[model samples]
Target: MDNISARENRQARLKRMLAPTSAVFIGGASMIPAVDNCRARGFQGPIYVVNPRRSELAGIPCVPNIASLPEVPEVAFIAVPRENVVGVVGELSAIGVAGAICNSAGFSEMRGGEQAQRDLVAAAGEMPVIGPNCPGVANFADRSVFMMDFFGEHDQNGSVALISNGGSYLSDLGSSDRSLPVAYSVGLGNQAMITAADVLDVVLDDERIRAVNIYFESIRNSAALSAAALKAARKGIPVIAIKGGRTTAGQRATQSHTASLAGDDTVASALFKRLGFVQVSTHTEALETLKMLVHAPKVKGRRTAYATSSGTYAVLGSDIAEANGLDLQPPSAEAAAEIEKHLPPFVHAANPLDIVSSADDGKKTLDIYRAFLSGNLDVAVNVMCYPPEGGWDPTTWDTNTTMFAQAARERGLPAAFVNTMPEMISRSVRERMIAEGLVPLQGLEDGLRAVSNAIRSSELAEIVARKSDEEILLPLYSANVTNPIALDEASAKAELANVGISVPRSVVVKPDQATSFEDLTFPVVVKALSADLSHKSELGAVALSLGTSDEAWRAVCSMAENLKKTAPEIAVSDFLVEEMVKDGVGELLVGIRRVDGIGLALTIGIGGTQAELLRDTATILLPASRDTIAEALRSLKLYQMLDGWRGRRKGDVEAAVDTIQKFSQFAISNGERFVEAEINPVIVRPQGKGVVAVDAVMRLAR
Candidate 1:
């Protein structure tokens, strides 16, 4: 087909698949819920059940085969056993069906099922297939439901679109008693034809979707989804994600669950952060984050205030806020005076604006909220908790919630509520708060963390949206090798220096030609250069702090002898003598390593002998902006030391950032040539002085 016609055909096919007028279900009693779901969705289109053993199912006429169908259905739900799924799909495709939702198991996820899954894909050429082993698909806008089981009563026009790889979460999110407004949801089992990225692309095109919730075991087509997500983020639609397989056991489970190949999680996290996705760790976090994005205004700053009746809540809230990077600033004296008007004389008016717990009425809570909203703060949080024995009064709570939500909206401020106890708040009350545009958070710690995450995501989205042409990624090295080859220290340092990075002045000479010392400083370091030996220090091939010419010469002779006697297999073609660097404030490790799916990951961390014990590192996606580099450095635990901890002089962080940028460019340009490149003990000096790389290594791909 030509370009225009092909595009048109795809568009039409997608329309039919998303809003199919008629659908076929190919199974027996297992498809009862699907039929009920179809009825509940108000799908007035024809429903054909193709079961050889049954004459009719759930009042729908059952046909013997695809050939016996009265008309070509727009879509088919294949629920047959795995062994027969490919043949059934082929038959349906021949009948000109637009797409199929293969809700069968035992495909590629199981042993000996790979070929069968391949056959199923081959059979459905040019037709969109949801999954060969999945929970199925649901479209609220068009009422196109195709699942073997029902979660709960769903709205016909929900706003949140969820796409996941796991079925249980899909069902859980769909059936949520909390009434999460999910419009479109699908579990892309196996993702043979339609991947998560493809589904994300389609869902993003829907104007009704205000947010996207995705839970993935792994990302197969990261680049495509990244672009799609970035587009959504720019349009102010948040993409919230929960990535499984972060731990070793979880990784193994994920591979078995969906035939997914989980890669380095740090790289994946960097990718998500770079693309402006709000990554969460749990279903609750994802839902809460989405709620904030959908309803709350953009957070202007971190300054926050809380209104609560209990003094203990004030303390708890303060701790949680500080832990999550939220600043619970004390109210200004003027603001405190304003709050004093509502509270009793014994109640101290502070940031958490402690209201007397013994107070009988909600006046103090409401007045404190008013004061918080009017004060010089970016956001407000209200803690509303009541014991069951305190006599549950719905009227007072309802009035208080409504007033709080209304005041926030009228004042153009973002506010959320923390129900200390999940069971304390009634379902109807929570729903009402949500409807009134107030984010009602349950569970104290979870609520606080959620609020902080929401604020940070908003800030990050704004930053990403404002970014322009601030990054340029160089081309990958054009090498066709298969194995990695280690480069000698001299060669590695030379490569780094060529990329505009500073290195210690060094001279390489054969064992017999080393009649030097006039051209070099007295106190120098000597090392035997050999690609075969990665750790020269361990092999006694290193000589440090030689104070004299004779001392350096004798060290080189001793290293050669040690190598020849102790480790004869190691080849030493030359030796390097380099001037020692002592004026250093700190040592750092800077390097690049390939991350599967994503490209090379540029990493920086605390270095020297403590590197292994501290294990403080930060990985950033390559070709990052200077601001990103600086932000990453600030995120490290060692930032305090680098920023002049304990009244010490600060390290030259700007110099380090510049060196990192240059290294990133070189790594990007030579991605295919090397598997890894690193400089250990990159001596960081005082501010204004540049950093110097003292030791280096490079591993080239064969």
Candidate 2:
């Protein structure tokens, strides 16, 4: 059957699933809420007790078995012995249960039987399973259906819903109303089957769910989750996810806890940012960020404006904004004129609107605030921190001094209140700030990161989707690919050259005919053209810049001999004697590597060892556009060098980007036939000018 049919069948099965007599079932010996948290918070959903020996629990009748239930259970919590899990699931599936909280242990995570656990989890036929070993699920706004409690007697704030893999950390993350109102809180123990992707689809499409906070551990299904997250992102629903396990030990712990396959944390970080998700590290920070997104409106663009009561807070705010890719627009001439008349001489007009030394000056703050209320700024940050030390504490600042925030809320501009005195702030004051549409963050960095990430989550999705439009029709070279000798660099370049790319002048040299320097030219490059010597440079199969005729002949003979050392028995072929290409404006490194879940990722970086050491690299998805290629280059850490650092001439940035963009098109065009290739030094020239490939390699996919 097709996807729609499969999905329709799953829905039908879900509808027939039984409803639990106890809406919230506790399978473990977890501590229950002593206070009337459920009734106080308007949770009228029935609470069910499923202990076999007990008759009643939490003032409700208890059922001995699944068949003894008053009605079919819509959801059930499983925490029986490991050996009995399969039998319990078998019965639950047979009875047509819709969803479940699998708290039982020993499926795959702690041990090594991944396949067995996967099969068992699939018994319910794609039914959503939270964990085989987990802390269970909670619907906070649906009336305290959780064994654990974050707050007492807290009403539905209608702000953000949170999902985490690690329950220990989230339980400690201050879930007070002082942050944002949390709609739901769920912890997936092992993430047995139904993943973050499926759950996110519900939140993204739900009108009541404003923003989502995902505390991720191991990502088993990245592509599915990414697609689901983008759905939420497109609807302006900010998703802040923290992929735990940055170190070896951390990764191991993560694997044990959630059976997650943790690879490189940097890769995970990069993936989160690229896929329009805000990546965080700690629970304290993720909580604050979620609150900010819930409190702040959707950002229109990157530009930001600042209006603050203190001078030092402005600097801290600007530093944070710039570091996180948020543009703090400089005050316009008109805004500057107004600043000049009322502001302190020391505080010059700039990106940060520092109404200098506002010791007793509320007007300076108000004037700057009102000016920015209609200025070129898309967002604003009004800092309430001490001099030189940025903290988040409302009690430290004058509580009455909230006019800057007032104007921002009135204008519907996304804004954050930056406070440095986190410890000094009272819970009541913090709640007041959140109620007034201001997110209370620990310091400058966290505050700006929260805002920038939320904006990037929405904007990056649109940006990446644009990449799907420009498709390609060419391929790259690789060594592992089949029939390498039949299609060498010269041949591959010749092929790509047909699809709009430039290749340098070259000629193939047979073993019988060796060319002297005087005959071939003063400077020439000798490249072994045999599949037997794939990694040419590694096997001394490549020689560049021959000064004399004798040296050129010797180099070729040596390369021919080394072919045996490179690939023992493979047949050898003629080499290439090409004129050495001259120095150009820039050396662009372009290569192709398959990215898991994202398909092919065309890489463009600074050539030579810096590409590895400095890691001054950027990536573009396959069939990327000229605009995306150019933007990707600009996004690198060492991109300033391409823009002419200090006084040096700017490398041919445009030409280099164009070449890579074309190569990406080529990679996609060739599809399965082409495996991979890399052009280390592509010479680039002036504006909109063409580029030349100095060296290239390709391997046809076997």
lDDT: which candidate is best?
A: 1
Give TM per candidate.
Answer: 0.86, 0.75
Candidate 2 residue lDDT tens string, 641-694: 667778656666766766776777787777666655667667765434557887
lDDT of 1 by residue, 33-63 (tens): 8888888877879889999999899888899
Q: Local distance difference test, per candidate?
A: 0.76, 0.62
- Top TM-score model: 1
lDDT of 1 at 275: 73
- What global local distance difference test value does model 1 have? 0.76
